[model samples]
Target chain A: MKKHHLRIPGPTEVPEQVLRAMQAPMINHRGEEFTSLFKKVSEEIKEVFQTKNDVLVFPSAGTGAMEAAIANLFSPGDLIVSFSCGVFGDRFADIAEAFGARVERIKVEWGRPVTYEIVRERISKDTKKEIKGVLFTHNETSTGVLNDIKSLREAVGDHPALVIVDAISSLGAVELNTDEWQIDVVVAGSQKALMIPPGLGLVSVSERAWKAVEDSKMPKYYWNFKNAKKSLEKGETPYTPAVSLVYALEESLKQIFDEGLENIIMRHKLLAKALREGLKNLGFRLFAQDSWASPTVTAVDISDFQGKINFSKALKNRFNITVAGGQEKLKGKIIRIGHVGYVDELDIINVLSAIEMILADEELFGKGVKAAEKVFNEGVEV
Target chain B: MKKHHLRIPGPTEVPEQVLRAMQAPMINHRGEEFTSLFKKVSEEIKEVFQTKNDVLVFPSAGTGAMEAAIANLFSPGDLIVSFSCGVFGDRFADIAEAFGARVERIKVEWGRPVTYEIVRERISKDTKKEIKGVLFTHNETSTGVLNDIKSLREAVGDHPALVIVDAISSLGAVELNTDEWQIDVVVAGSQKALMIPPGLGLVSVSERAWKAVEDSKMPKYYWNFKNAKKSLEKGETPYTPAVSLVYALEESLKQIFDEGLENIIMRHKLLAKALREGLKNLGFRLFAQDSWASPTVTAVDISDFQGKINFSKALKNRFNITVAGGQEKLKGKIIRIGHVGYVDELDIINVLSAIEMILADEELFGKGVKAAEKVFNEGVEV
Candidate 1:
């Protein structure tokens, strides 16, 4: 009875209730029942986003949402500021560039967050106000770094540049006040902290972003924000949506609401703390700086280990545990352990023990477990 | 014990086996297991497409695939001929126009298929041969009309126009030989005849379309076929896929293959015949002409009925049966009964009886049942 434990940064474990909810029979997307379901789900999603802005749902992965943001809010030759600290941040910039945006990318080190000082400096230097938008990632999944969105928005101060955030791996697990931070657009995916499968891409649009959409001349049909908004007014999508995922999202949202959003965020923070302490005790170096480490995923440096590639394979083969390896330039140098949706302390403990067992080192295993327990015992007071 | 019947044109009845398959635990999409699954599903999809060309799967609705075809296969200001007979057909043209294509629309009356003569006339008139592609729908779900692709392709004889088809609701339930018909691109969705929920958009691109892609200047990121094809060669998708839907698709494909493609098409034909006969006996007229009526969805004229709005409401409220109504200009004038996906003869009989009951006419019910039974008794033989 060996159960596989999934600890990927995204596509984390989904609860059985959510899976069962998705198993329900199909419903007509254009019908009364589905309209009500659609409305309810939209409302719930907005609640999670902590915004009164329109939340548009698309039958796509997070990258699609990122593209939608660029295509809908900017026209050809529009200048934009894109901050890149990791792979996902770079991807956000790439989407903008693909749509003909002249992007001035602010590159930061892989394991560091995009500092507010750099953002302030960039926006201040743009006295001409040629930049139409600022594209950044709330949480860099590849590096497990979380940028300070509120501080970045504050730095943009009174500027017309829309703040478009890729909150794919962070939204539900972290404290993101969309409206308070004045983010023009926030792009997210279902397979991350939402505790659902990959298919649906959720985006929250502010009135300012809607204005940008109106003036935008970028060629788009499927990802057109106006069509989505119009259909959403009628409680339907412009195109057919991924119905099963919506059902699963309903169940997942129910679980989220029951636990409360604030508590969920706190739980994630505590879990990350425990996992980081465990890794530290096991003599593993943390990938990201402590100040901006993402609560959703923890990256541990494995470059010093002799069998880096073999380590992930042995963990899966021996204990049926799945963790993610570093992507791009950091490949084979780090392992990412996701503590996102549907994950709890027991799951974390199981993963820690499995890693220790794979190492076959008693002293490290004892110290790691003790460190994790100390963190867990303190409890998530928030 | 009231089991609701889903008879909409899409979001059709999914099989229990497929639903169960979707309930499986999440697997790493970038891992060996998912790579194997992805390859197997791609090959099976090609079998259903009836083509040796590449079949690209996107985690989006059918409209996304339509957008993909336009974005990848044509540059801005590229001349294209789009034949519009119904809502979906017009939508195809809209996508092309949105991408800056100068489309020559061959508009036919609603509920009628675009004839080969009209296509030939349009193509022959373009003596300059400036038209890069000819876009048409295989099955227009809005009006229950199925155009003749083979005839249309033959009409474009020695021309350089690429034959792009929207086969969202007809591919599996109709006889469409992609290679034999020389189709350049075919776009389809999962929820119609594919017996799955709404999420995946499957597009098959011939060698000709690939050439068009190389020269296309339209900007694309999310729906870029080149990136998708590149990743597919490595047994992966450029972006994360809706993994659960792929699992469900595998199960759905097994059911399709087990029953046989030819037999499935025959079943749809026979079921459609039964449904049309039943509607006819009940003093109703078919919306589409009999010669080119779609076998997947049967549209019945409801303009003369005083209780047009109440009809669908009564069907759902009283019988728990869901069917589709017409769109655009035909709304509240026609009701569409979908026999696509997992629907059978018994399901059709139940719907017919429910319609009769809603009318409160015993004589109509008896005649309808008899007409349906006569066709069902004949049995489908491929």
Candidate 2:
């Protein structure tokens, strides 16, 4: 049997146990068994999200949760300050715009993170806090830039505006202290770092978010926060959820907790470091600088070889390693390698080894995999 | 080994093949494998939807698809006539109202079907054709009433109002010719007669509906029809879909085709008829009259044993047979026995015997199971 691996940012490699979890028979969503399972999963999800507030799960993509945050926190014409580094950040801001919000974006170069200096400079202008909310992409998977949401929170500095973070590709892989950072809402997807499929969208709401939700005048039914919260109290969802995916989440959370959150985060960091160093050793430049590079995914700049070589496609055809090509303006300029949920040190080495084989450059190819292995040897237990 | 069965109306029992299908490892959503799979699924879905139009699949419950119909078809403050007979019907209207539609509900008794007479009577009064859309629940799972959409279509003859139907529970179980009925949009769920788990929400859109979509001024992002349509051309979703559920759909659609659509519809009818007759013979009254009784689920009037003896809970506790209790005002008044999606005559007989055992009344106990068997024996195949 041929083996295939997903090295894309989301819908990462589901473990054998987690995949088996999806094979479990369907259960009643409103019944005792599912109620208990949901309650358990809901509680466990918070540990990974690092939130004190309840995480409301929906049966849509991370984008749905992003839309939910926009629709629930503010009304039309609400002023929102969007700090966008790359594609996902732009999408979050775009969602706010689509919902009729007047978004003033603090745009940065694609390969750079949205620093707190720019945030403070803009937020300080809002004396009355006319900006009702702020949107930030914690991890811009497209450009491998991970903005520091904790620092951004401090930049807001007791401003009444809600701080919403799109942690779709970063949550669980990295630390996102929702309550500690005073982040009003954090939207996440099941597929990214949760080791589940792409159906379930999780959103953690703090006390501040609930207050904003009450004042929101937006019209919503399916993604309505009040209905989701009301049902979460009963250990149920307002509508039928992805029951099988929830089962998978239960199993994946068990693996995550077994590995320990701190260990998992460290593992991600080590793997990303190894991959990045290995890529650089192979004569590849990274899109984001080391200071802002994402732990879950790495964007390898291929601008030098854009028309001359096809990096991601070569890996896909030769080794069955599915990596993502760039999007929008970054298209054909960079190749993204995902090392998120269920990926280990060996996975990084294998991908690096494959890249080396694909390139077949005598001087550069042999050095990359060895460099990745060295990182694994120097790091903690793989 | 405990075998728990789901006999709910929405999240019906998934087949073994479909459950196993969910075990397949995650793949990249934007990859070629997924593109081909999506393309094949998109084509196969139309056969069941009975339309030439593209069926947009969302990673949410059927309620989300219902909301998508409301959000994508008509703008805010548009006049809509919602013919509501049950909770879901009322919910469709509520979603329209939540989206700022001027909804005028033609309400009927909970157990009664929304007849053509009621639709025509209301439609004729709107001579100016101010009614932008008409919302109908083809099969009200809450009351086990199946309204005749073809008749309703005739009643709205020559009217420009878009006819939207919530066929979540009835689409695959019963016969629905989307093109023949000229239904502008029909929302369906995966867990029903598709024999998949509760995740995917599918909607078939007509060309007329696309024109309305072009003119729709409603602010939407996740459920935006234009984005979905554009992506459909590329055999991809605008966002990450429930990949496992889509895999399950492929397997389940194969099952659907192998059994043949007409045979599947007949089987659902046979199973429902036997369950209904068995329950009737056991001294249980039906909620919906025989004239408009649904062929997917049967509602047994349990008001007689509401407080005295819990029917659905007793079935669950003693037999591990999960059935649905009534919702909203009908709570504790009826018990719904779902016979759609992977259910056969044997399932009906087994559930009937369990109900008889739970009743334990000498006059009503033995006859129910035997009556179910007679229906099965007279039927062509289980």
Q: Give the alpha-carbon lDDT of every model.
A: 0.86, 0.85
- For candidate 2, write residues B160-232 as lDDT tens digits: 9999999999988798999988999999999899989888999999999999999998879999989998998
Clash count, candidate 1? 0
* Local accuracy of candidate 2 as per-residue lDDT tens digits, A63-128: 999999999999999999899988899899999999899988889998998888999998898887
lDDT of 1 at B55: 99
The 10 consecutive residues of candidate 1 chain B with the worst lDDT sum are B361-370
Residue-level lDDT tens digits of model 1 in A291-363: 8999999998988895544667876775567899999988999989998998876566556655665566434
lDDT, candidate 2, at B262? 92
- Kindly give the stretch of ten consecutive residues in candidate 1 chain A with the minimal lDDT sum: A361-370
The DockQ of each candidate is: 0.01, 0.01
Best by the lDDT measure: 1
